[model samples]
Target: IRYSVVAGGFHEGEISCMDICIQRPIIATLSKEDSSIRVWNYDSGECELVKSYHSLQKEFQNTNQTYLQSVALHPSGFYMAVSFIDRVKVYHLMQNEIREYRSLDIKNCHSLKFSTGGQYLACID
Candidate 1:
C-alpha cells in the first residue's frame, strides 16, 4: 500500500530525502538540504516534529554548521540516525520530543541504517 503525506511547515529550503519507520507504518521522517529533520504521521498528514540545524547543533556544540547527508529511522520507530558532515547522531523520539541519544565521531557520513532487529545502527561515510 502507498500513502501520501503533505507536511505542514514553512521551509527555508527544499527537502533532500525521506524515510519511513518500519514498525510504525504511519510515521515518516524527512530530511532537508538545509540540515533539518521533520517527523510526521502520514495517516494524518500532519507534522509531528521539527528539528532545525541550529537546534540540533546546539546539542553537540557544533560551531561549524553542517548539512544532513542522510537519515534513517529505526525499525521500532523510537529512534532515528542521521549523518552530517563530521558525525553521525542518533535521536530518540518520545512524546513529541526529539533528543540526542548518542553521538559518533565520524567524518563525512553519507548514509545510515538500523539493523533488522533494531539492535544495531550502521553508518557509511
Candidate 2:
C-alpha cells in the first residue's frame, strides 16, 4: 500500500486526536493546543467545519475551564462525539455545519469511539 498527503497547513496546532467515518470521506479532528474541533473532507481536501471550545462554552454559558480530549466520527458520518476534560458532547453534522445534539456528563473523558454499527458510543475516563 502507498500513502500520500491529501491536505496540509490547515491546523495551527498539533492534532491531539482524530477519527474517520466509515460511510463517508469525513474525518473528525481535535487540537488540544487550539481547543478546537475540525471536520475535514479528505477526498476533496477541504475543511468542512471548525468549532472552538471557547465558543461552545460561551454558547452554553459554561464558565469552567476545560481541555479537549478526543474526537470520534460515527460510522454513518452523521454524528461526531467530542470528549473534553469536563464532559462529552455529541454533534449532528449537516451541510458542513455542526449542531448541538446531546451532552454526556462523563467527566475527564480521555477517549471516545463509536461502535462499528454506530449504535453505541464508548468512552474512557
Candidate 3:
C-alpha cells in the first residue's frame, strides 16, 4: 500500500477513500474532505493532476459538497468515473474534458464498473 497525503484542490481537508488500478501504472484517488479526483502516475509516482474541477468550483464559490463518494478507473485505462453522493461523472482521460462524457445521477453511486471492452457501464447503487 502506497500512502501519500492528498489535498483536495477546493476543499480544505483531505479525503480517505481512494482506488488504484490493479495492474498498476495508474492510480485514482478521492478524499471526502475535498471531493476532488486525482490521477497519478503509478510507475513514477508523479502527480498528473487530471481533474480538480469539482473542488476548484466549490472553492471558487466558497461552497462545499454535501457528500463525497468513491472513484474508479475503467478497465481499458482510458476513462475514469468519480462518484459523489448521488452523481457520477464519467471522464475521458486522454482529453481532460468533463463535457466529453456523460454523468449518471444515481442514489449512492459509490461503485461503478465497465465491462471488459469498456463498451458498457454499470452503476452499483
Candidate 4:
C-alpha cells in the first residue's frame, strides 16, 4: 500500500496525543502542546476542536505549561479518552451530542490506551 499526507500542522511542537477510528471513513483525534484536542475528518478536510474540561478551570487557565498529554479513541468509535496533567477523562460521541462520560484520577498521566474489548483503559506517566 502507498501513503499520502492527509493534513499538516504541529510543525513547531511535537504532537502530544493522537488516536484514530478503526472502521472505515476514518476519524482522527489529535492534541498538540496545548490542552485542546482536535477531531479531523481527513476525507472532507474538516477539523473541529475539542477542549478539555480541565482547561476551563481557573487554575488551568493560569498555567502556561498545562496541556493534554495523551489521547485514545475507543475501538467502537463511540468514545474518546484524554489524559491531562493528573486526570483522565472519557467522552461519549453521538450523532448530535457529545459529553463527558467519566473521569479517573491518575497523577501525571502521559500516555493512555483502551483495551481491544474497550472494557478497560490503561495509562502511564
RMSD for each model, in Å, please? 5.1, 4.7, 5.4, 4.7
Predicted structure 2, TM vs. truth: 0.83
Off by over 4 Å in 2: 1-9, 55-66
Better of 2 and 4 by lDDT: 2
Candidate topping lDDT: 2
Candidate 1 global lDDT = 0.74
Model 3 poorest 10 in a row by lDDT: 5-14
lDDT, candidate 4, 1-125, per-residue tens: 99966665432345555778775343545545444566665666555434544444446665665656678888887888878777888988755446789988887888888888888898887
Query: Model 2, poorest ten-residue lDDT window?
Result: 57-66
Any idea what lDDT model 4 has? 0.67
Strongest candidate by TM-score: 2
What is candidate 3's TM-score against the reference?
0.65
> Per-residue lDDT tens digits of candidate 3, residues 24-49?
47777776655566777757656566
Candidate lDDT scores, in order, read 0.74, 0.84, 0.64, 0.67
Identify the superior model by TM-score, candidate 1 or candidate 3: 1
TM-score of every prediction relative to native: 0.77, 0.83, 0.65, 0.70
Candidate 2 positional error at 93, Å: 0.7
Which runs of model 1 end up more than 4 angstroms from their true locations?
1-5, 26-32, 55-66
- The segments of candidate 4 whose C-alpha lies over 4 angstroms from its true place after superposition are 1-14, 52-64
> Which ranges of candidate 3 are over 4 A from the true structure?
1-14, 22-24, 53-65, 95-100
What's the true lDDT of residue 35 in model 1? Answer: 58
